[model samples]
Target: MLGFLTARQAGLDDPLRLRRAESTRRVLSLTLNPDRDVDRVHGNGVNAIDIDAVEGRYMLSGGADGVIVIYDLENFSGKPQYTCKAVCTVGRSSRHVHKFSVETVQWYPYDTGMFVSSSFDKTMKVWDTETLKPAEVFEFEDNVYSHHLSPIARKHSLIAVGTKNPKIQLCDLKSGSRIHVLQGHRAEVLAVRWSPRYEHILATASADSKVKVWDVRRASGSVLTLDQHNGDKSKASSEAVNTAHNGRVNGLCFTGDGLHLLTTGTDDRMRLWNSATGENTLVNYGKVCNESRKRLQFTVSRGCSPEFVFVPCGSSVAVYALHTGELVTMLRGHYNNVDCCEFHTDYQELYSGGKDCNILAWVPILRTADVEEESNSAPTRAVGQASVNPAFQDAWSSDED
Candidate 1:
């Protein structure tokens, strides 16, 4: 319907004629409903949010007040305005729960029974969702910034953890141990991500202003180091290594296809790059304010013709078109600086949090007609799920192999 509207609104009779224009972009926003009343939260602020990709109807949020809450994302109350209900929470009573701010939270890509959280207390705890207890805990020497479990790594069930130490530790889930460290940067490693396109590939953005792409299977050298000032067309071998940003690189997010990467730096810039080539695309997102001393948690929209990037600005979230570098619009609601944002492609919704002690939800503007048509066309699935992603493949390979 969107494509049809784009073509008909332009009075273009042919499909080929409709494909060339750049004005087809659309912007919409739906007000978010918080899990509790706006004044009810402990009010320390929200830190992290994780939307269940497989089910898409449940999510988890960790707060600076050290509370972990699960929310149901469905329209169960049959009201005009739907509220996100709190399904469960890890309250202050749990002795082993994180004592300080929970910096990051993520679900095991393949399972609903397991989730992970890292805190300023220097520990990463893996929890059994049903039992709501720490199944395994890994201690660290410094504050952990972020950690990621490879979405499609089947051979190696490892979680890559970033910290103030500048080294990224790969923890093996099955063995319940730290396997090995990937060391390079001289400052804090703020963000760590495994390539969705390749199992052994890893990318790290550091406080040192450098973004390094590594082939985890190799110990001899880095595969590529990104430099922003290098000529756009120059290959990694031809460009000067390091110097990707003038300051700390705060945000690291990959497009849904994982062929490209989006980075935001304290240098107040955002750049897109070819993930495989390690070459910058040179899309100029003008002076995006990234005050995050820690890496920013941004998300990319999926399924759109040209996807968009959602990033947290001062007290609002800015939406920008990928590849084109055009600012779409800003989402305004939070009173304090927004820290993180997550996108849910299945329902065309966005969830973002900040230091304002509130989590705001955004969605495309929907009419009574659109909602009715959607309800008539399909049935909504129950929140949460059984089984795991078959997409999981072992990523473990010995140096000899």
Candidate 2:
């Protein structure tokens, strides 16, 4: 660590290298934090969570009980132990609250004054943050499963929405109306995501076992329907042609660069794909244990070397190395099945929500002086002792000892 700092100070090494190394180290050291907690505001499972891109200080969460909360993530008390308090909430009492499960929530990409949420109530509401009222509402005939606003969009103000309907709906924020529909999937569209790199590129996953990439500017059909077999005619059966998974693909996430895409399915599998070519990278993330019939929200790390992917696998959140598909660790905390998770890129922290009605924070343990000294003396021994934190140790009776 000191070597990198010395080189950085001497202007000999690229600053991004040091940043990546530290970020990677921080991610590897993450564990369920004992001191930090999110105020339990949900009576039902938390369905989605997102941190604001502008400040990264506030977090938005949607719950099964039709509640939406904004948490103040900035710890102004200058203490290690702090509970993230809900700054405001759209409770059941609110007239603007969803009538059913709030499936997805997201802060406006450029500002905190506006946000959006979708629900099984068959409506997507564009909200005014200060007034806690719906600025605009887009109603649909089917239950909304997922929705996404383009984070990099400058030319358009479109929000891509997935629903029980097979067609993907694109709502124009400027006109306050459903402007376009992209049709291809034969079943419910389970998930939709806009590319972080290109404003017009979008990806959708469906219960029909297909994942399709679209260029919204074109009036034609999908640009490419991802093929798990890489278009090998002999390998693909007739029924499996151009299918991304064998079952419902409920999750879709793009890597930071938007060059790669990750999809999770009910087939108990997660596949990585090349977004541009619609070719499966075939990175085998062995059985992910997905059982969710609705949209499953997962996230990928940003600003870290060898970025990691975080997915809810049963009752725990599983961390995997992006390219290698190696399981790095399982973050256990929730007592019930985890439904969603989000990475706080600025702080190198993670927040996950689950059926347990809890949102757990996973924080990185800072390197202590004693551990640093030990590592300098005997690196292997220090590495072995890393997990020996007293907080995680179990107590045993004298008889057992």
Candidate 3:
């Protein structure tokens, strides 16, 4: 560790090398933080969770009880242990509360002043953070499954929405209307995600066992329909016929760089793909036990070498290497099936919520070796330097005269 520090300080190693090493170690050391547990406010199962893109200080959670809660994750008590209390909530008594389960909740990418939530009631409502009132409402003919606003989009303020309807809706936040719809999937569109790399590129997953990538700018339809076989019809198995999965594809997430995409399905499998070409990179993440009939919410780690994907597996959160498909660890805290997991990239921490009506915080375990090393070396280094350096000798002078 000292050698690593010396090399890092001397500029002979990548500055991020130390950080990556620490991040990796921290990830491997992830443990349930009892001190940082969030207050259980939801009356029913939590359906979704999201950390804001801007400040990352506040977290949003939607529950099956039709409640939306915002929690302030910052510890202001100056104590080692502190509970993350709910700052505000759209309770059942609220007139603006969703009439049914809130399927998805997300903060506006650019600001925390606004947020959006979609529900099984067939409506997506945008709320003002300060007023706790709906700023805009999008009505649909079918149950809304999932929705997302591009964190990197500058050309437009569009929210990609998937629903029980096969068509994916793009709602314009700036114009306050449905901007357009992308049509390709044959079954209910379960998940929709905008590319982190290109503002116009979007990915949609559906119950029809297909994942399609569309260029919203082009009206001709999806640019590519992900096929496991890479168009090898002769060698294509039934499972490889222009489908991303063999069962309902319920989850979709892009890697931090937007160069790759990850999808999970009821087939108990997860696949990684090149976003540019839609070719299944075929990183075989074996049997990722998923049984959700609704959208599965998962997230990928950011700013870490060999990033990890955190997916809800039954009552636990499964952590796997993003590209290598190796299971890293299982966070087994939830008493019921975990519905959603959110990652805090800044601290490499994880927050997960589930039917158990609990939110668990997984934080990196702090290694004591460095602290011990510093403590053990401090006096020795000072004494050793006192012999040669006048500054150290003066600081330690017994004869003050």
Candidate 4:
């Protein structure tokens, strides 16, 4: 009877149980907006890119064929159909050939002089802009899917890496040795992210269909395991287990404040979970198909009325209202399936990459007069900010609309 029940329950994912999660995310109807305000610039399908924090004048991208590109995103010319020229690339013949498709590239967060890239070849390298040479290289046992450096980690100089192996590795930037490993994931870990609020806190997603939050300082065990059901015995364990995802949990990200975690699964679902507890928030993003074996990079608008989540769905990039789970807008331009995306807070701008080998920029709809308005509309309370846990308040008042 136990075996019969297990087999029957394994085939189901209870929608009612999922709906009973502490919070139900809303889904917004997306009104396709033209990506006019920001420029659509890359010539090839872009693999990755990063925005400049200080100047806000330049952007950088890495391509599928191993081309690292830099673009000046400012409106240099008076015309609207502006072209973004290749500033420089590490170019061909460089040993940094990123043996397989370049998986992820990111800016150093604080400065423009350096950036980082991870590859299927099982390595992550820090690159110096001036020489385009690897400043630091860390090699791993299996393919590296994704890696992230904290945006504001001041004390611990560590980079979190997710590889084909089930373990999460922490490599020290200040030292050359691998500091520690966070284990428990039984399948290849796909994404690794650090909490903005807690310096030592890290989160990981895996092929095992579990999302685990860890404390890098502890060797004990995971702090939380994201379960689909709220540990309700009335539901079958299979139904409880399948709650998180039916496929690989490929992408994981925390909101700015570290209260909520966003996950994109190969099962065509995007879920919001409370960071403090592993409770699935049940904000239903209908079908977010993430086929990539690596992390599906998504971004949160730094300052907005209601925060937004930018996820790369199948062939296009889908923007969803963070907590409500509504699809706000789709930024279409890349002829191929979009892969990764990043957001800039100060200007409320977005950039995305796809298999079509191009990177597109998206921004709010602005007229000439609206563009000329010299008003700093930055959100006052970081409301609607894509924070990780349950703490960030919705800064934007829906009453205004």
Candidate 5:
């Protein structure tokens, strides 16, 4: 660490190298935050969670009880020990509540005025954030498994939806109706995601053990189909030329930059792929226990040099190196199977929910000296003491009293 800092000071290393080092150190020190907790309001397990891109101050969660909640994550109390309280909730008594389990919930990318939720009741509802009333409802013939609105799309307001049926549905928020269907999978479509880099690109995973990437503007079939065998017919058996996993592919997420994609399946394996060429990176993220029959919501770190992937594995959330596929750590708190997790880039914090009916917050661990000094008036480092590691000294501010 000192060598990197010395090189940085001497103008020999890239400035990004220093930032990546700091980000890596912070990520490696993550621990469950005992002080911060999202208030519990769901009667059943939480299935989906999302933090909007605009502010990252508010969070949304949907649960099996057919309830949706919005939480104010900011600590306005001006103290270290402050709870993130629920701002508002759409409870079961509400006339607009879903009849069955809410499978997914996401905020509108551009604003907080509207959000979307899909449920097993075969309906996806768009709600006015202020009134908590359904502004638009799109009904499906089968149970809706997952839906995602492109976060970076400027030309389209399309929401890619997957259902119990093999066909993937694309609904346009502007038209308030189902615009088209992309068909290729032979079984239920369990997961769907839009490319953060390209507005026209979409990805879908299915029970048929296949993952396909499509271009919405093309009249032809998918642009690329991910093949675990990489088109090596000799090594491939009687199976199709393209198969992302050997079992049901239930989870899909793109990296922070949308350069690569990460997928998890019921096969107890997670694979990373090159989003452009559809080649499996073949980074072996060993047995990531996934048994969910529905869409599994996972997330990746943003604004970090070497990012990490957070996936729900059994009763714990497994954190792995995004590029190397190394299992960094396992967050074990939920008594039941964890279903979903969302990463907050602003503070390098993590929020997760599961069958335990609880949402747990994970924050980067602060040094003991700093924490102790903040708790009470204690002797910290002297004003003019030379530090053993110059990196800490360079990063630490000198304005403290």
Candidate 6:
């Protein structure tokens, strides 16, 4: 760590190199923080969560009880112990609240004044943040599973929505109507995401065990369908032809640059893919343990040397080396199954929600002065030593029950 600083001070290293090194170090030291907490605002499981890109200080969460909340993540009290308070909420008392489980919630990419949410009640609502009311509501015939708005789109205001119907719907915020539909999947569409790099490119995952990428401008059909076998005729069986997984694909997320895509499935597997060519990178993330019938929300870290992927695995959040498929650590806190996780890139923090009806904050531990002195003296101590936090130790016994 001192070597990188010295080289940076001497103008012998790229500034980005120092930044990446520090970011990677912080990610490796993440643990469930005992001081920081998020207020419990939902009566049921949290289905989705998102951090706003504009300020990164406000977080939005959707719950199975049809509640939505916005939390203030910034700590201004000059204290280490802080609880992120809910600034506002759309409670069940509100007439505009969804009638069923709120499946997905996302902030407007360019501004915080407007946001969107989709629900199992078969409607997607565009909300006015200040008013806490729906500005526009688009009704559908089937339950909505997931939806996404392009973060880099400058030429369009379309929201890609996945639902119980196989076809993906494109809703226009400008025209206040469903403008187009991309038809290809054979079962319920489980997840949808727009590329951060290109405005027109979109990806969709379905229960039929297929993932398809589309160029919405073409209006013909899907441009590519991910094949786990990499198009090898002999290795792929007839039933597995052009399938991304052996079961339902419930999660989809792109790396920060949108160059690669990560997916989770009911087959207890997660696969990485090359976004452009639709080729499976074949990096084996062993046994992700996904059993959700609805969309699972996961995320990736930005501005790190070797980027990391965070996915909800059972009751814990699994951190993996993005390119190498190495399991770095498991953040355990929730007692029930986890459903969603979001990375706060600027602060190097993580927030996860689960069926336990809790939102846990995972913060990086500060490097102690004693550890630094020991590292300087020994110069051979392993950097990846196991954590000594008592919360990490398992205490469950077979005789308890």
Clashes of each: 10, 0, 0, 30, 0, 0
lDDT of 4 by residue, 285-373 (tens): 78776777666778776544356788887777777778888766565566788877877655566777777766665544333344566
Q: Is candidate 3 or candidate 4 better by TM-score?
A: 3
TM-score of each: 0.83, 0.92, 0.91, 0.79, 0.91, 0.92
lDDT of 5 at 176: 95
Native-structure RMSD, model 5:
5.6
Q: Per-residue lDDT for 39-62 in model 2, tens only?
A: 999999999999999999999999
Q: Give candidate 2 regions above 4 Å deviation.
A: 370-401
Error of 1 at 177 (Å): 0.6
Clashing pairs in 6: none
| Global CA lDDT computed for model 6 | 0.90
Off by over 4 Å in 6: 370-401
Q: Relative to the unseen true structure, what is the C-alpha lDDT of residue 290 in candidate 6, on a scale of 0 to 100?
A: 94
Cα displacement (angstroms), candidate 6, residue 7, comes to 1.0
Backbone clash total, candidate 3: 0
Task: Evaluate model 1: give its lDDT.
Answer: 0.76
In the range 1-401, model 6's lDDT, one tens digit per residue, is 67778888999989787788777767777877776889999999999999999999999999999999999999997665789999999999999999999999999999999999999999999999999999999999999999999999999999999999999999999999999999999999999999999999999999999999999999699999999999997998899999999999999999999999999999999999999999999998898999899999999999986789999999999988899887878888898999999999998899999999999988776667545655353322233222532321121111111
- Candidate 3 residue runs with Cα over 4 Å from true position: 237-240, 370-401
Q: What is the C-alpha RMSD of each candidate to the true structure, in Å?
A: 10.7, 6.7, 9.7, 12.9, 5.6, 7.0
lDDT of each: 0.76, 0.90, 0.87, 0.70, 0.87, 0.90
- For residue 163, model 6's alpha carbon misses the true position, in angstroms, by 0.5
Error of 5 at 7 (Å): 6.5
Ranking by lDDT: 6, 2, 5, 3, 1, 4
